[model samples]
Target: MTRHHPRPRPLAALLALGLVVAATALVWARAGAGPDRCVERAERAEQRSELVTGTGPEVLVIGDSYSVGAGVQPDQSWPVRLPGRVRVDGFSGSGFSAGASGCGDLSYATRAPRSLRTTTRLVVVEGGLNDTDQPVADLEGGARRLLRLLDGRRVLVVGPPATPDRTWGEVARVDATLQRLAGEYGASYLSMLDADLTYQDDDLHPDPAGHREFGDIVAAQVEAMLTSS
Candidate 1:
């Protein structure tokens, strides 16, 4: 008896080929889109953050996701709700040299040059959690670059809030270094570590109510800074 080999199953072959092609296309799409999307989103966030569209002139606040209000509405973001016309230059996933994404080299040093004008009033910078792993030298350098850019403008440097992702020890180091930099530059330093606040599910950012409280504290700090200056 001659047994003929079963003919190649056209349906099975087609389904296998289809799956392979689909998977390949998906990988290609992700590979092409990932970095470009990162940069594009970052740029758009920056553009949105810089509008001088408030009541009058503006106070500037610059930082990462927190400053941009990641988990909340643009209007509800603390910077917009802040007591004055506020110009902001915050972007998510940004830091001096470290962050949760894109490895974060988007430091204030890089931003303030392009974002700040000589006429800007006071600037508040809220970052540190993103700089948790940064070298003291790098952190200081970033802060100094920003302070120099501000020159005669009043500035405040805000420390990050508590996050379970980092040990308090790691967070403290960054805060201490920033505190030193603030003193050196005469920019005020406000530690959220000292605030009575609540956080969102992510624990990395604050909720709407938290932002309101945060805006109040920042307003108070700015008022004091303005009065003292």
Candidate 2:
């Protein structure tokens, strides 16, 4: 009888390859999944509030370095330009998923409620650029947590702007996730990628002029929403 022996090495190699492919597919799928659902209602409230308020509504801008106007001053940031009392609660070096243990205690979602007690009419949460470097699951969980915290509030989600170093595909994915999250949470989603281009500097953080231009675009969108409402 002929000895029948399977090639263990080839089989092992094929199995490893299959595992790698499957893992990659899973990561891709998770990354592509839409934003967290907890904040959908807040997103909607933002739109409705915009339509009803007419010109300008109270806004709370919360995030990391981006929202803090890293390279710019306080006055140039969008939070400084909104019609009503605009409170800026962004922290430098704080990632969207960052907690007290990671970097700082001021998370965009957590610090927001604590800082602004008087029923802020609108809230803008922007972060995730830092989280992109972490695991996709971590990003999703952090986003969901933030959404949950914003439940029953009005919110508008600003996503990560495009960078020359990052691929357009990555930007699109991030933006898509943001839009989906806004939709699910009932908030309005705005793209800052295009607005970023109008700025003169190529630094990850925009300059004062860049901040001013960004503020204008954001103000216009807020105005439009208020007018429609």
Candidate 3:
């Protein structure tokens, strides 16, 4: 008869079992094995920010502090990376208006006419952080109004970027709401709500690199709009 095999070591067996469990969990998570995994993966994608893609028209950019290069140098702003002739009329602490309270009743739409020169081929509505304090209804209405004013122009509504302090839900709401409004008004929407995007130490404004990233993203979108139109 063959000699009896040495009994498996209890500690070794437990350790092996633990490793198998951990490996299985990792694989399951990556494969989106269940509802929790699916949600987790979706969340990861939603929160990521990296390079973005196009060339196009003489574009006009209107936004808030993010538009104005809050913490970063002026050259790092998103508007600086546009294709063709660009006009940047970004307000540091202003947003669209649904009433007298929003941006002193002079919103991007109201201020846009004055900022235009030659022929504005595209209107990039950049930031809405100033509208965060405003009621949601007002924000939506203001966006609607501003988009309406850009009527025939190729308008790109770039949703407000997400900050570390703001929960995912808050940022998602702002982004989804604005995107919906953009769709309603026949404008294209580009979300800047990725959590992985760079930000300043304050965690509010984009760092120089972040702005550059945003610029690249908008440039790509601009190219698409121009080519398609």
lDDT of each: 0.73, 0.60, 0.69
lDDT score, candidate 1: 0.73
Candidate scoring better on lDDT of 1 and 3: 1
How many steric overlaps does candidate 3 have? 4
Instruction: Please provide, for model 2 over 1-229, each residue's C-alpha lDDT reduced to its tens digit, 9 standing for 90 to 100.
Output: 9999975678788899999778756653543311232133234323322332113466677776656665554555555655555666665545455432133333455665565556577777776565556555655666667788888876778787776646666666667777777788788888876765434354466667666666777777766655565
In terms of TM-score, how similar is model 2 to the real structure? 0.66
Question: Which ten residues in a row are the worst by lDDT in model 2?
Answer: 33-42
- TM-scores for candidates 1 onward, in order: 0.76, 0.66, 0.69
- TM-score between candidate 3 and the true structure: 0.69
Clashing residue pairs in all predictions, respectively, total 0, 14, 4
Q: Supply the global lDDT for candidate 2.
A: 0.60
Sorted on TM-score, best first, the list reads 1, 3, 2
lDDT of 1 by residue, 90-205 (tens): 87766654223352356777777777776677788888886776677777777777777777778888887667666888888888888887898887889877666667887768
What is the TM-score of candidate 1? 0.76
Q: Rank the candidates by lDDT, best first.
A: 1, 3, 2
Query: Residue pairs in steric clash, candidate 3?
Result: 53-220, 54-220, 54-223, 55-223
